[model samples]
Target: LFICIDHVGLAVPDLDEAVKFHTEVLGWRELHREVNEEQGVAEAMMGTGDQLAENARIQLIAPLNEDSTIAKFLAKNGQGIQQMAYRVADLDHVSAVLRERGMRLLYPEARRGTSGSRINFVHPKDARGVLLELVELPKEAEEH
Candidate 1:
């Protein structure tokens, strides 16, 4: 159903501070940064070293406004790990199989994700309280 852990999402109150800490203290390098208006988030994708293609990354997400889910999460639980993403070769097929197994997906259709990957989420309740995201990297983005 999945290839590997794509990236772990962290909800932060401040994106710059988190990125700074991750880069300076934790030694993670910032690979990408963007504001997803549709999702009401400003995120930074951090990688460990040279292998950006295969390495597991950490996504630091901060709320763009109070209406953002990240803001709500922070208000309720403070800053921390928010979601776990699993990489898939075929998101549509995997989503279908998961649905057949009685998993409740959060979206009816896949949405755009970091680096133009297709993504969808499994309901937190269905995944035992951890928000599970499934990501299918674009074909040309895959490491050969």
Candidate 2:
């Protein structure tokens, strides 16, 4: 079952600039940052509230390579919101449900995401033109 809106993924042309904008201008805290070579993107998580709290946050993602999905997104649509992520209690069950409902999953299986969460995306066409993500966070990361 779905827990909550985990984070909003934003595609940006420049990762460093986006991080600087959020941290320096908006005064949001940079919770974490990392480069996911497998995904070919560099990402940083920024939030306004408590770091340990389960709150909606922004995930700034930029292309790490020309062939990355972020690069293609920037090329086709410029920089903007890319995906809305929902945290799930059981990713496998959720995936099965989606498949049973005939929804198209972008990935055949869950893949490693930021902060070591298992993540998968639903095809945008099946989600009313907006890409949707399902994330299963590590046990230790869950709120009490």
Candidate 3:
């Protein structure tokens, strides 16, 4: 049901500031930037621009509204590890298993996520106080 670690989500107060810091200090290149309106947040993926894909991903996220969860987290805890997303082969199977085990889900159903993959987030309570995001890509979506 689960594949591998997709990416680590880091909440940031300001996306541009974080982006500039990472680009200038760490020398990472910006791979993509996107605003997930449904999720009420914006994000940027930074990487080394080399052959290694997984080694250089740093996702910076900022909230779109003051009332948003990200905004609340930033206000209370400051910018830090927001969640960890894992790539999965079968979202339904994973969700069903998690439900059977009494795990709480942040999203009742899978929704659109970055890179065109379907995603669902598990509650922090069930994920050892860390939000867990599960991502699954359709076969057709993976081909391209």
Candidate 4:
């Protein structure tokens, strides 16, 4: 079953600049930054507050190549909400249900995601016009 909102992604022009702006100027902690070539994006994760508390995350996304979706998104709509991620128990099962409903997926199947989790994206058209991401964390990652 679907669980929780993992984090909201924001498309940015530059990952480094956004990281600097959030950390130096706003005083947030840089939790992690990594490039997922398969996704064609460079991502930066910023922690707004302690994890023990109700803290949100700032995810800055920048295109790694000109052909990237984020690149096209910036060219068309400018920097803004990229996608919303939702945690899930079994992505495979959800995929079957979505397929049975004729919903389209951005990825053919789930793939390794940031922080070593598994993720898949549903098309905006099928997700009520909001790009939705389904994520399943690795067992080891979840144990922590």
TM-scores across all candidates?
Answer: 0.96, 0.94, 0.88, 0.89
Where's the lowest-lDDT run of ten residues in candidate 2?
47-56
Candidate 4 lDDT by residue in tens digits, 1-144? 687787789999999898898889999788888999988999987777666135577678999999999999999999989899887878889877887899898878799888888999889999898998888877775644
Tens-digit lDDT track of model 1 for 45-138: 9987657565669999999999999999999999999999999999999999999999999889999888888999999999999999999988
lDDT, candidates in the order shown: 0.92, 0.90, 0.84, 0.85
Runs of candidate 1 with Cα error greater than 4 angstroms are none
Backbone clashes in model 3? 0
Query: Which stretches of candidate 3 lie above 4 Å from their native place?
Result: 50-55, 138-141
Q: For candidate 2, give the lDDT.
A: 0.90
2: Cα error in model 1, Å: 0.7
The alpha-carbon lDDT assigned to residue 13 of candidate 2 equals: 95
Residues 1-144, model 2: lDDT tens digits: 688889999999998899999889989888899999999999999877775465559899999999999999999999999999998999999999998998999888899999999999989999899999999998888753
lDDT of 3 by residue, 1-144 (tens): 577787789999999999999899989888889999888889997877643234547688999998778899999899999998888888978998998899988778889887677889899987889899998865674544
**Distance (Å) between predicted and true CA of 35, model 4?**
0.8
Compute the lDDT of residue 35 as modeled in candidate 2.
Answer: 94
Better of 3 and 4 by lDDT: 4
Q: Which candidate wins on lDDT?
A: 1
Cα RMSD of predicted structure 3: 2.1
In terms of TM-score, how similar is model 4 to the real structure?
0.89
Q: Which scores greater on TM-score, model 1 or model 3?
A: 1
